[model samples]
Structures are given as structure tokens and as C-alpha cells.
Target chain A: MIQMFHVTKAYPGDPPVLVDINLDIDKGEFVFLTGPSGAGKSTLLKLMFLAERATRGQVLLAGRNVARLRESGIPFLRRNIGVVFQDFKLLPTRTVAENVGFTLDVLGTPRDEVRDRSLKMLRRVGLEHKADVSPLKLSGGEQQRVSLARALVNDPALLLADEPTGNLDPALTVEIMDLLTDVNARGTTIVVATHDATLIERYQKRTLRLEKGTVVADERGAKAARLMSQTA
Target chain B: MSVASKLAYFGRTAIGSIVRSPFVHVIAVASLSLALVGFGVARIARAQLDALVDALGGEVELTVYLAEDAAPEQVAELEQALTQRTGGEVHRISPAEALGRLATQLGEDGKALTELPQNPLPWSLEVRLPKAARDAEALGELSRRTRALPFVTGVDYGEEALVRLGLIARALEVASLVVFSLVFLTAVIVVSATLQLAIFARREEIEIQKLVGATDRFVRVPFLLEGLLQGLLASGLALGALVGLVRWLESSAAGPLAFARLDGQLAVEWPRLAGELVGIGCALGLSGSFIAVRRFLRV
Candidate 1:
């Protein structure tokens, strides 16, 4: 679960990126953060992951205020949160299996177990056949699946994907979204930040729309239709 | 994870990095070998210089010749004084003994010495000082003290040769230190620069590792291992090259090198030298990797 009461984030000599944001995301929930470029959707997810700190107010995760967490505590906190990037930050030199198993490797899981679990996760993403191939040789969608496998390998409680389908075509984007939905169905809280209104309209999940450093709307499932209508 | 598993992981990752970029590893190892070779050669030369100094020091002695008409009691007094002052053996050579030695030195032309009207050789006390007093300054001081003794006519010591040898030894020691420092600096810089390139090549991997919740130590251990492996390989290569070089010097056109003729083998202690070289290589590698990885870890 997460909570942010009056959180404000700013860089030096610049206007506040996220101003007076008040929000709450409950456990096992799948939330979509939709905003235009420079609208602070990624910044909000970064704060939740403790990758960034709020200049004012507290941001709480799992009932603990992460803004007060020490730097040394960040990694342990991140262990419970999986992040997938738009560019698919897989190590090019590593095989797909190695890329997927990296999270377990960081946790120092037993070698056989790491291999087994990584293979299983790759299978779930339907990329087990490509495990031994280099990420460089995989298609963008396949690489993104490997990234998803890596994120879910450790069974983290929360998943944050910043435009996970940004580089994919419509078909691949749907596949990625379905995989994310499957992960969410397995009881992992998910927050995906993207500007894709089509995916948002199609998914019909709870969408928090941001504009000018403020949450302009918080719509759920059917209510999301009204917000999209207003935007149009 | 258990320590063993962690180490295993680190080792595999390090070796994987090296395998992925053979050119970088090769360049690093070659540069390290060059630096280590310079240090190895300098160490051997220093050992040889020390041996030479020891050989020359062992041969140093002072001969205090008594006055031609000196009385027996005065000669005995001078001998006793020298023995007490130097804490060394003082052998008294009588006129007969002195003439006998002179005749032996003359070899084939000694027939005229036996027909002389009277013995002209003066009695002398051969003063053999300890090794500590064999240097130029110490021997000079000892000679000055002996010449002022009663019944002592003159003192003959290898002053010029001892002084020259001492100067050479001192200069060689300074040169060895300078060479060692220069080589060490060069090794560190080259290793650091090479590791910097290696780290840059793997920056994406490092960033991925960090994002996946890998501890800083977990990320750092692989680079450290990489540096360590480079250093170890470099050291082995340098040692092999050094042994080959020494063997070549021994069998070269000029005949066996004087230093390599130490009891029919090279003067350097192979095992100890190898150990030291490897230790230095490891240190250089560790430091280089540590420095190069620091800026990247900030992310």
C-alpha cells in the first residue's frame, strides 16, 4: 500500500515537478498513471520506489514513510518493488536467462534455484525457448518480456512500469499489457505510467490523470470512461 | 546467499566480463606485465648489487707495518692495542715472515732477495676488522687511529677501492628505489586507466544490477575480481618472462652473466620473488578497480 499526503518534489532553481500531490494506492491494486510529457507521472513512481525524495510532505509505502528511509535502506526497500523501464534495461552481454535471473542473483539465491525460477518466469512470459539467446538478438517485445520476467522473478509485492509498452507496436503492446494484467491477477500491486490513451481506454483500470504537477482526475473502471470523454 | 556461492557468482561474472571483452583484458594484462617486468628486473639488479657489496666488504683489511727499528715490547703493545680497539684478530708478522711473503710475491725473481746483507722487511700487524667496519668511512677512521699508535710506521688499507665500492653501492640502492617507485606508479596508473575502460564498457550492466536491488558490495565485488584476475595473470606472465630473460642472459654471447653465476644459479630467490610480484600485482589491480568503480557507484 502507498500513501502520499501533500508531497511536493522540486529541483534547484526549477518549478516544482509534483506539487501538493495527495494520493493513496491500496494493496493488490493495479493503477495507471496517465499524463502528458513533463506531467510528473514517472516522478511519482520514482518517489514510491524511493528513487527520489519529496521536497515536502511524506510519501508512505506499506504503511512506512519512505521519505524518512535511509540511503542504505533503499536497496532492501527496492527488493519488494519491481521496476520495468521503457527501454528494457537488459544487460546486452548477458543471455536472456541471465537477464531474467538477475534479480534473484542480486538476492543471492542458490544457483540451481535461480536458474529454475528464472526459467519458470521466462516460461510464464512465453520466452523460455529464448532463454539462452542474448537480449540483443531478441525482438523488442521479447526483450520487454524478459524484463518483465526479471521484475517478477523475485515475486515482489509491487511493480512499477514506466511506459513498458512505449517501444512496441499495437499487438506487442497488448501482449505486454496482458502479461502485466496476469501479474496483477497473481496479487501483485501494479502502477504503470504511460501516455497511451488507447491502452488506458481499452484496459479500463483505475487511472490517475496528472497535469501541471497535480492529479487532475482519479477515475475507476467505468468512471474512467467519463474522464476520457471530458478530455476529448 | 552463502559466502561460497557469492564468491562463485562474483568469479563467474568477472570472468564473463573478461571473456566478453578480450581486447580490453589483454591490453590491461599486457600493460600490467610491462610494469611488473620493470620492477622484477630492478629487484634482481638490486640483489646483485648487494651481493657485490658483500663480497667487496669481506675482503677489506688494514695492515699496520711497525718501524724498522721498533723494539719487541713496542710491537707487542701496538698489537694488543689494535686487537682491543677493533675487537678483531691481530696477526703479528715477524721480519722473517714478512721477507718470506715478499719472496713468494716475487715468484720467479726472488733469488736476489735471499742474498741480501740483512733483512729489510719490517714486522707488521695485520688487523682484520669486522664486517660493520668494512665501509670507507669506518675503515678510514680505523686506519687513522692505527697510524697514530706508537711503533706503527704506516697503515695500508684498500681505501680507494672500498670508497669507490661504497659509492657504487649507495648509488645503486638509490637507483633501485627510484626504479621501484616509478614502476609502481606506472603500474597503478595503467591498471586504473584500463579498469576505467572496462567499467565504462560494463556501466549498463552495473546500472541494471543496481536497479534490480543488488547491493553496492554485490556490484563492486565483480569489478574487484576482474582487477584481481588481471593482476594475477599479468604477474604470472611477468614472472615467466623474467625467468626466460635471466636464462637468456646466462647463456648469451658474453657467457654467463656475473650475477647469474651465483653458485651456478641466478641470485634472485624464485619463490619469494614470485610471491612478492604477485602480491604487488594484486594490490595494483585492487586499487585500480576500486578507484575506477567509485564514480560509477554514485548512481
Candidate 2:
């Protein structure tokens, strides 16, 4: 769960990137953050993850104020949150299994358990056969799947994916969205940031549309649910 | 994760990084080895100087020449006084024995000494100072005391030479310390720079690790281990090279050319020396990586 109250972030000599934003994301909710480039979607996710501090106002995660967390406390807080970067951020030299298992490794998991859990997560992402191959050798879709596996392997309470399928084809985008939906159904709250209107329209999840750093639309997927209900 | 598993992961990552970048590793190792070798040479030189000082300090002797007109009682009294003060055995050399020693010094020309009408050499008491009393100041004090004794003509202990030897020994000690410190600092800098390069190369990976909930310790321990391994390997290599060098010097023309035959006595204590070098290597490695990681970890 995440809550942001009137949050504003700015750099020196520049206008604020995000302004007076108030938002709440409940547990196990899957939400889409849609905007063009520089609409501050990434900045918002970064604030929740404590990757970037808010210039003003308050941000809370799971009832804890992120601004009050000590530097030493950041890593433990991060352990409960998983992030998937648009670029995948896979260590090119590491194999798919190693890349996915890196989170557990950092958590001091045993090697056998890490391997088993990592393989199981890779299987969920349909990349089990590519576990031993370097991420560099994988296609764009496979690489994104590897990133997803890595993010979800620890079963973190919250998942933040920034343009998870930004580099993939349309078909791959749908596949990734379906995987994210499955993960949310399993009770991992997910927040995805993207500018791809088509994917947002297709998935028809609770969408928060941003323009110029301000939330302009907070649609609760009622229309999509009605359409689905009629189709069923 | 257990501490053992964390340590194993760190070690494996360190080795992997080294294997992945052999050229960089070689450069780091070579620089560290050169610095360590310089330190090792300084250690050997200091040890040799210490042994020389000990040998020379033990051999310091004072010869007291008795006045020609002095009576036997006065001579006996002076000998007794010197024996008690010096805490060393004394040997009395008669004038005839002194003449014989002079003849031996003159070599084949000693027949001329035998042709003299009378033995002109003065009777002397050679007092060998105890090792503890052999310092330049102590020997000078002893000489001054002996000169004030009745029936004493003069005391000869090569005072100036003793003073110069003491100065040399002190200078050697100070020089060794300075050289060791400078080389140790150079080694730290070399290792730090080398580690900085490695960190820069892996900056992206480190950032990713941080994003993936890795603690600063988790990210840093591997680099520290890498630096430590480099230091240990470099120092071990340097020690090996030093041992081989000492052996070669002892067997080659350089052995006889050296100031002192640096055989077993002047050689370094291998076990202790090895332990010290390795310890220094580890310390250097840890500090170097620690410094190098600071700039990169700000992200």
C-alpha cells in the first residue's frame, strides 16, 4: 500500500517535475500510470521506493513515513518492494538464472534455495529453458520476462514496473500485461508506469492519467468492467 | 542467508570479476607487487643493519696504557677498579707482549723491532666492555673514568669511530622506517587507484544491486574482498620474488660484493616476515577498496 499527499519534487533552477500530487494505492491493487515523457510517472514510483526523496509533503508506504526512514533502513524497506526498469537492468554478464536469483542472493538465501526459487520464478515467466543463458543473448521480450522473474522471485509486497514492455512488440506487451495481472491476482500490489495508450486501453485497469506532472484523470476501470461483463 | 553463504557469494563474485578482467587484475597485482618488493628489500636491509650493530657493539674494547714509571701496586689498583666498573673480564699485556704484537703488525720488518735496545711498548690492560655498556656514550664515560685513574697514561677505544658507527646505526633505523612508510603508502595508493577503476567499470552493476534491495554492505563486501585478494596475491608474489632474489644474491658474484655476507644471520626471519607482508597486504587491500567505494556508493 502507498499514499502520497501533496508531493512536489524539483531540481535546482528548474520547475517542479511533480506538483501537489495526492494519490492512494491499496493492497493487492493493480494500477496503471499513463503519461507522455517527463509527466513525472517515474518520479512518483521512485518516491514510493525511496529512490528519490520528495521535495515537499509526505509519502507513506504500508503505514510508514518514507521521509523518516534512516539511510541504513532504506535497504530493508526496499526488500519489500520490487522494481522493473524499462531497460530491464539485467547484469549482462550474468546468466538468466543468476540475474533472477540475485535478489535472494542479496537476502542471504542458501545457494540451493536460490537456484530452485529462481528457476521456479523463471518458469512462471516462461524463461526456464533460458535460465543458463546470458541475458545479453536473449531477445527484448525474453529480457523483459527475466526482469519480471527477478522482480517477483522474492514475492515482494509491492511491484513497480516502469514501462515493462516499452521495448517489446505488441504481442509481447500483452503477454507481459497478462503476467502482471496474474501476479496481482496472487496478491502482490502492482503499479506500472507507461505512455503506451494502446496497452493502457487494452488492459483496462484502474488508470491514472497524468499531463504536465499533474493527475488529470483517475478512472477506476468501471467502463472496462462493464464491457467485460457484457462480453461474458 | 547465513554469514557463510554471504561470504561465499562475495568470494565468488570477487574471483569472477578478476577472471572477467584479467588485464586489469594483472596491472593491479604488478603495481602492488612492486611496492611490496620495495618494502621487503627495506626490511632485509634494516635486519642486516641491526645484526651489524649488534656484532660491532659486542666487540667494543678499551685499552688502558700504564705510565712507564708507575709501580706494580698502582697498576694492580687501576686494573681492579676498571674490572669492577666495567663488569667485564680484563687481560694484562706485559710490555714484552706488546712488543710482540707490534712485531706481528710490522710483518717481515719485525726483525727491526727485535734489534731495539729495549722494549719501548707500554704495559696495557685491555678491558672488553660488556655488551650492555658498549654504546658510544657509555664507552666515552668509561674512557673518561679510566683516564682519571692513577698510573693511566691514555685510554684508546677509537672513540670517534664508535660515535660514527652509532650514528650510522641510528640513521639506518630511521631510513628504514621512512622507506617502509613511503612504500606502504605507495602500495595503498596503487591499490586504491586500481580498485577505483574496477568500481567504475562495475558502476552500473552496483547501482542495479542497490535497486534490488542489496545493502551497502552486500554491495561493498565483494569489492573489499577483491581488493584484499589482490593485495594478498601481490604480496605473496613479492615475497616469493624476494626469497629467490636473496638466494640468487647469495650464490652469485653479488654475494661477495655485498658489505656483509648476508647468509643466515643477516637474512630476514622468513616466517615472521611473510606474516607481516601478508598482513600489510590485507590491510592495504581493505583500505584501498574502502576509499574507492565511497565515491561510487553515493548513488
Candidate 3:
């Protein structure tokens, strides 16, 4: 769960990127943060993940004030959140399974469990057979799936994705979205930032539209909410 | 993973990275080994020089020869004058005793010395200064004062030459320290530069690690391991090179240049010096890795 009140983010020599913003995301909710280029969508997500601090006001993640968090505690907080990027961010030198297991390794998980869970996650992503192959050799769709597997392997409570499908073709875009929807159905909160209007209309998730550092509209897709409840 | 497993993982990844870029690792190792060799050589030279100065500076004595026709009384007078002037223990050597010493020095050719004209050697006085009077300036003054004795024919102490060599040895000691310090700093910089390249090559991997909630320490340990491995390998190479150099010098010590013979002067404290070199090598590696990680890896 995340709550931001009167959040403002500004950079030196530039206008405010996100100003006077307020929003709430409940546990297990799926959110579509839609905005044009440079509309502060990514910046908003950054504040939630503790990548950057708010210029004004407060950020609360799961009832903890982020601004007051000590530097040493940041890593522990991040353990509960997963992030995916447009570029996949997979290490080409590593196999798909290693990529997934990296997060578990950082947590000091047992070796046997890490291997079993990583392989299990790869199977869920329909890439179990490709687990031993280098990420460099996988197709864009497969690579994106590997990235998703890595993010979700730790079973984080919240997932923040920035333009997760910006580089994928339309078919692959839907493939990733369906995977995200499936993850949401299993009770992980998801916030995806994008400018793809068609995808928004098709998925029909709760949408928060931003323009010039301000939230212009917030539309809860009622039909999508009903579908999610039925799946639960 | 367990702590043991984590350490194993870090070690494997570090070795893998090094293997992936063998050329870069080789170059780094070579540069570091050369730098260490320079430092080792300077350190050994300074130590040897210090030992030599200490050995030669001890047991400093002067030998003054009497005129050929000087009377026994004159010799006695000169000996008494030397004792009073230097406050040193004086031993008189009669001309006959000097001739006997020459014959003994001739060894198997003592007969040839006996065949010479009768008692050609002169009476001499050996002045042995106490430890307190061995200062260069004091010895020089004493030598000058003894040469002015009317019955004295010649004075020999080699004090001036020893003083000059001591000055050169002192200068070399300072030079060696400066050279060692400079090379050590330069080696650290070289290591830092090399590691920067390695870090840049893995920037994407690092970014993904950070994204997956890897702590800064988790991300840094691999690079630190890599630096440590490089340093260890370089130090091994340097030790080998130093041994070979010492052996080669020892083999050639029998050549015409007598001064080139170390005469066991190069028998350094091997275990201590090796430990120091290894310690320094590790320090250089760790320092460079830390700087690189701090500068480039924001996490």
C-alpha cells in the first residue's frame, strides 16, 4: 500500500516534475499511471520506491514515512518492492535462471531453494526450457519474460514498472500485460507507468492520468475491478 | 544463501569476471608486479647500504708510521704525543716486529721477505680510539693533528673516504624511501583506473542488481574480490622476479669488480619483507577497488 500527500518533486534549474500530488493505492490493487513524455509518471514511482525523496510533503509506503527512513534501512525496504524497466535490464553474461535467482541470492536465500524457486518461476513464465541459456540469446519477448521472472521471484508485495512494454511489439505487449494481470490476481500490487492509450482501454485497470506534474484524471475501471474480484 | 555459500558465489563471480577479460587482468597484473619490483629493489638497496655503513663505521683505527732514521726515544715520544692528543690506546711496533708481521702476511713466500735488505720496515704506532671518539669530524681533526707530529712520516685512517660513502649512503636511503612511496601511490592509481574499466563493462549488471534490491555491499564484494585476486597474483610474480634477480647477482659476484660482490650483504629478512610486500599489494588492490566502486556505482 502506498499513500502520497501534497508530494512535490523539483530539480535544480528545472520546473517541478511532480507538484501538489496526492494518491492512494490499496493492497493488491492494479494501477495504470498514464502520462505523456516528461509528465512525472516515472518520478512519482521513484518517490514510492525511495529512489528519490519528495521535494515537499510526505510519502508513506505500507504505513512507514519514507522521508524519515535512515540510509541503512533503504535496502531492507526495497526488498519488499520489485521494479521492471523497458530495457529488460538482464545481464547478458548470465543465464535466464541465474538472472531470476539473483534477487534471492541478494536476500541470502539457501542455494537449493534459490535454484528451485528460480526454475519454478521460469516455468510459470513459460521459459523453463530456456533457463540455462544466456539472456543475450533470447528474443525480446522472452527476455522481457525473464526480467519479469526475476522481479517476481522474490514474491514482493508491490511491483513498480516503468514503461515495461515500451520496446516490445503489440503482440509481446499484450503477453507482458497478461502476465502482470495474472500476478495481480495472485495478490501483488502493481503500478505500471506508460503512454499506451490502447493498452489502457483494453486492460481497463484503475487509471491515473498525469499532465505537467499534475494528476488530471483518476478513473477506476469498474468492469476490471469486478473481473479481478471474481478471479480472487 | 548461507554465509559460506555467499562467499563462494562472490569468489566464483569474481574469478569468472577475471577470466572473461583475461587480457585486461593480465595487463593489470603485469603493471602491478613491475611497480612492486621497483619498490622491493629500492628497499633492499637501502637496507644493504645501511648495514654496510654500520659495519665499516665500527672498529675505526689509525696507523701512523715513523721516519726511517728516527731514534727509539723519538718513536717513544711520538707514541706518547699520539696518546695525549687522541686520548686513545697506543701500541708501539718496533721495526723488527714490523718486518716479522710482513713475513707472516707473505704466507708461503715468507722466505722471499727474509731475503730482502735487513729490517727495511719502520716503527709504527697504532692508535685505537674509544667508541666515543669515532665521529667523522673528530677523527679528521685527530688525523690532521697526528700528521703534524715531527717524528711522523705518514698517517692512514681512510676516515675521509668513509665519511663520503656515509653521505652517499644517507642520500640513497632518502631517495629509496621517496621512490617507494611514489611507486606505491602510482600503483594504486593504476589499479583504480583498471578497475574503472571493469566496472564500466558491467554497469548494466550492476544496475539490475540494484533494481532487485541487492545491497550496496552485496554489489561491491565481487569487485573487491577481483582486486584482491589481481594483487595476490602480482605479488607472487614480484617475489619470483626478486629471487631471480638476487640469484643472478650472486652468481656474477665472482667477477673482476670486487665491490660488486655482496659478501652476504644481500641476505635480507626474507620472511618479513615478503609479508610486507604482500600486505602492501593487498592494500593497493583494496584501496583501488573501493575508490572505483564508490565513484561509479551509485548504489
Q: Assess each prediction's global lDDT (C-alpha) against the native.
A: 0.85, 0.84, 0.81
Model 1 C-alpha lDDT per residue in residues B68-177, reported as the tens digit of each score: 77888887877787777767788988889989888999998887899999998888888776766666776788789878876678999888977887788879888889
Badly placed stretches (over 4 Å) of model 1 are A5-16, A55-57, A169-172, B66-115, B125-131, B140-154, B253-266
**Which predicted model would earn the best TM-score?**
2
lDDT of 1 by residue, A1-232 (tens): 9899999999999999999999999999999898788999988988987767899999999988886777677788888999987778898888899888899999989989999999999998789999899899998878888888898899999999988887788987887789889889999999999888888888899999999899999999978856765774
Q: Write the per-residue lDDT of candidate 2 for residues B190-284, one digit (tens) a residue.
A: 77887788678788888888887888888999888988898899889989999998777666745443556444334579998899889887887
| Model 3, span B112-219: residue lDDT tens | 877787777777888886545556687777778778877778888777765775586668778877887887788777777876776777787776677667788988
Best by DockQ: 1
The candidate maximizing lDDT is 1
**DockQ leaderboard ranking:** 1, 2, 3
Q: Sort by TM-score, best first.
A: 2, 1, 3
TM-score of 3: 0.80
Instruction: For model 2, report DockQ.
Output: 0.67
lDDT of 2 at A159: 99
iRMS (Å) per candidate: 1.1, 1.1, 1.7
Comparing candidate 1 with candidate 2, which one achieves the higher DockQ? 1
